[model samples]
Target: MDSPFTSKLGTNYCPTAEDAVEIQAFLAQPLRQMECLDRKIAELQHALNKLLEEREGLGSIVQSHEALLSPIRRMPADMMQEIFLACLPTHRNCVMDAREAPLLLGRICSAWRALSLATPRLWASLHIVDRGEPPQRTGCGRCPSMARTGWSVPTIPFAAI
Candidate 1:
């Protein structure tokens, strides 16, 4: 029962060989336990890595299924066509601007583009203005904020007219 710290005047008593042997045995048990714990930690780390890989694989599968679940993909072609027709801009004159409604619809996706092009009604609405005609001065959208946002109405090219 000797304390860890001792004064210089304290007895420097040494234990017997039997006592030393018992202490060594006591320390060996804990050493073996520590080795067992280390093995378990390694096994758990490997298991965690495997679980993460499994989760990633499942996530990709889920994402693909979710893409298929999209409402737009499920819409009937006739209904979708009606919706596309409904999206046409009402105020446009006979100008051919790419950023305009009918043209912009084609830029969306291959499905919408095919639908837009196939639907003669959408193209038939185009009103061609003469190149000599002046543009609407009121709609210049020359406000500093509008110009900064790059949202100004795109003008139809004179050559395309």
Candidate 2:
């Protein structure tokens, strides 16, 4: 019997059994490609979700740090001074880095830098020790001599020394 589906060239387009198999195989290629694309989309969605979650966690941490910093900014000047004084090292070390003090204090903010600079006693204590032979007896470590003048004082505040 002649198939209804026919090309202008008179070929039977309503496939025979063998032809049906080939047609099904050809159709399966697109299905397989679609499945692969679906899997990739799902993986991308999971990755995006994970990144969003991480961003939220980091945002919360930033907010917490900002909240913590706000109180320090609002602190009374006199009280802040006391806190800065209390934060000073009790012992002076000859091998100290003047850079270290400002660096640590600067971690807070500009106000901290000003406060630390204003406190002369905070930089006054110098206790340089020479476990080995003193290099020159005139200078400490890599710190500049100008910064070391505070240490030259015979005695600093007892709390500071």
In angstroms, the error of model 1 at 47 is: 6.6
TM-score of each: 0.42, 0.45
lDDT of 1 at 109: 85
Query: Residue 107 of candidate 2: its Cα lDDT?
Result: 56
Q: Which ten residues in a row have the lowest lDDT in candidate 2?
A: 152-161
lDDT of candidate 1 over 37-146, digit per residue (tens): 99999999999999999999999999999988999988888887687677776666334466866677789888888776666555544444344545664244422222
lDDT of 1: 0.64
State the C-alpha lDDT per candidate: 0.64, 0.61
Superposing all C-alpha atoms, what RMSD in Å does each candidate have to the true structure? 12.1, 11.5
Alpha carbon deviation, residue 110, candidate 2 (Å): 2.8
Best by TM-score: 2
Query: Which ranges in model 1 have alpha carbons more than 4 Å from their true place?
Result: 1-53, 94-100, 127-161
